[model samples]
Target chain A: MKQWMTLLNKELLEMTRNFKWIWVPIVFILIAVMEPITAYYMPQIIDSLGDLPDGAVIELPVPSAEEVLVASLSQYNTLGLLVIILSSMGIIAGERKSGVAGLILVKPVSYTAFVTAKWAGAMLLLWISYFIGYFVSWYYVGILFDTIPFIDFIQSFFIYGLWLSFVLTITVFFNSFLKSPGAVGFLSFAAVIVLIVISGTFSKWFEWSPAQLLSYASTFIMSGPISSDVWAAIILSVSGIIMLLGGSIAIFRRKELA
Target chain B: MSVVHVKNLKKNYQKHEVIKGIDFELMDKKCIALLGANGAGKTTTLQMLSGLMKPTNGEILFSGSREGDDFRHLIGYLPQHPVFYDWMTGREFLEYAGKLSGLSKKDSKKRTQELLELVGIEEAKNRRIGKYSGGMKQRLGIAQAIIHRPKLVILDEPVSALDPFGRREVLELMGRLKKETAILFSTHILNDAEEVCDEILFLHNGRLVESGTMEQLRDKHQQAKIDLEFKEDAARYADLFTALVKVQSHAIKRNKISFFVEDIELAKIGFLKVIAERNLPLVKFEISRTSLEEVFMKVVEK
Candidate 1:
């Protein structure tokens, strides 16, 4: 337990020093802030455009605060997730590649602690940045449109957080066996894309897959607990994260650190 | 004070075996040098011993250790090219390493401070490790390895890449560390091993070719040889010595003459008698023993 905490503290310190603390959050916040400003000014932006020709009229329906927040989430799914994957691509691979992991493991540290601490660190960085950005979106939506109910905001927020957790977990799992950080990033992106593609193509059969997390979160915001599939998805997603993290530990222990 | 007994320790990468069933003992508080050429399984053996790499088929038993024991606390390790969180200061890295070794926060701080002083890097402890020179990083590596007072410290070519000054500094530190803990370090340079280690294990092509103390190795591989330096060119005396009965072979270079003999004691008396009787100019004459280099060569070439 002490060794795990020690490594966890070291990981946090590394993040602080390596500029991850500053840049990761900045990227997420920028993505968060982009949605509301663009949503509110999109009509005016279209009005100012000369492409529509003189006195041309294009009817634009103003999206609700809940809808704005949901649209903001799409940005998170793309740009925000890209930042998370790229930033955390080297979390374990870098350490093992550079030979630092061998030094620590020779001490009284367990392989379980070593692998989990890395997962925990990446999770912490993900959630911290995500929440900070989510709160910004909340603030902007309150000012521009009708306020979302407190219960609705919190539920959707956690669900989106779970989705982010699932993505980071996939990245961590690939990181254990992959040599190149670049490959880890590519494969992580590929793995999520495959999951979502399969989920999208076979929606009826794969309704409870983690690929449905963003929609479940959106549903929670617009309405409350519409289907038992959301509950099943929540359970499966959390278990997926736990299982991947456990698998990473098992891989780290089994493979020679060379 | 503990002994590490490695029995038929083997490692295979894919199908080709890297460490071919090697066996050796790392005695209590004694420095053992794993001497071998590149790709000779020196690093692989050290890695297995450090618990960084698992052996394919072997039993590495630590004295007094029970089955399924978490004995890693008894060992510390440094790689050939150790990479750290370059952003961390020397002091911080040591403290972090100490804490990982299961020390309390306060104890970690205290031990880090002591190690910094002991390793003579106290002046630059606050500076980031990335800014440290090769020598400073090496000193820090040794300090971290022994911070927990482990029974064994495994170093994989700890000084192979350093300049002369850096090598001397690290060599001095290793010499001092032998009093506290057992050290297993790998080096291709025979002189460094001869100078620092109490015992040498010659690893060649993934096998334990030879293992013994320098004295024992020297005695076992010693030949009946004598080196004679002349006041002038020694070529004139070479043929005269080669013609003698005890002299098996002779070689001459510049002002020196080397004689390989069947009986050193008998040959020495015969050669000295001729030198005095013939009024020859003999500046230096001494019986020679096989050096560690020759022993290493014979072991590896075999």
Candidate 2:
């Protein structure tokens, strides 16, 4: 337990000292602030089509609370995806490439503790970033829509946490096996793309696929209760986390430092 | 008790056998130098002993309660080329290493400071390792290796990258470690093995060709050579020296001459008697011990 704490602290210190939090938070903030600002200006952007030579009449619908939530939530999802890729690339691959893993492995810490700490630390950073974005989106939604669902916002984040956990595991798995940050990112991005494709292409598993969670994050924010599909997505995503983590530990156990 | 025990260890990479059935025992509080040419399995042996790489066939046992799974924490290993996080400072690196080795956060921080001081890098502790010189990296490498104060320290060419001054300091620090810990270091440079090592393990072509105290190895394998300089021109009595029984080979360059003999004791005695009888003033003649380089060359040649 103490060893795990030391590793956790060391990991936390790394994130804090490296100014990683600065960029992480900024990225989320930009997305959060952009959501409502984009929503408030979106109609104006369409109205600017008045410059069309044909003078075509276009019907515009009033942006509802659901529309506002979806716009902000989708923007937040895109930003979260970027956060997962950027932050995770360094989590395990950086340690391995820098030769830091050898020193740590030689120590008294268990592999489980080391992997868990790394996974937890990365997830914690992303979680913080996600919530900051969540707060900003909520504040903007209140400004534009004149209403805020505080309890609903918190619950939506809880569900979003499950999806971020899935991203964290995939990052770790590739980080261990692949030593390059870019390669890990490329592989992870490809995996996410494939998951998205699979969910879209196969109607049967679409609801259960982990990819469904990212799209449904907006639904939760609009006072949509956590549905059976969300539960299935959580289960599937967590299962992927277990397999990836297990493979990482197994590969690390046999890796030759020299 | 031997802190490390390797019995008939073997490692093969594909069809090529890197370490062909080698064995060695490392007892507590003793430093052993593993000297060999490149590809002689010195690094491979060190890697296996540190448990970083598994051998194809062998039984490696650590002494006492510190054995098997728990044995890892008791061994400190410095690889030939240590890779460190470029972003982390030397102090942070050591703290990370210490924590991994099972030290508490408080203890790891304290030990990191102490190790930095020990390696004479306290001033540069805050500097990221990427900015360090070659020597500084090597020192930091050693610092991290010994942070836990393991029972056995395996340095795979630790000083190979350091400057002469840095090498000397690292050697001195290693020598100091001899009082408390056991070190098994591999080096292609025999001088390093000679300067600090208590014993030598010579490897040639993936086998343990020879191993002993420096003195024992010299006495066992060396063909004594005498640096002979006569009071008069030494070259004049070349035939006279060869005429004496016991001298197997003799070389004369200018006035100074050198002779090789199977038995240095016998040859020394005979040469002196000849000098006295000839009434030749002997300016200088001394039996020289075989240099570690000579020993290495001879072992590798065989």
Task: Provide TM-scores for the models.
Answer: 0.93, 0.88
For all candidates in order, the CA lDDT equals 0.87, 0.80
In angstroms, give how far residue A109 of model 1 lies from its true place. 0.5
Please give, as one word, the docking class of candidate 1. medium
Off by over 4 Å in 2: A43-60, A76-79, A146-148, A222-227, B65-68, B105-114, B227-244, B249-258, B263-287
**lDDT by residue for model 1 (B2-59), tens:** 5788889999999999999988878887999999999999988988888777889988
Cα RMSD of all models vs. native, in order, equals 2.5, 3.8
Candidate 1 local lDDT, residue B80 = 86
DockQ of every candidate structure? 0.76, 0.44
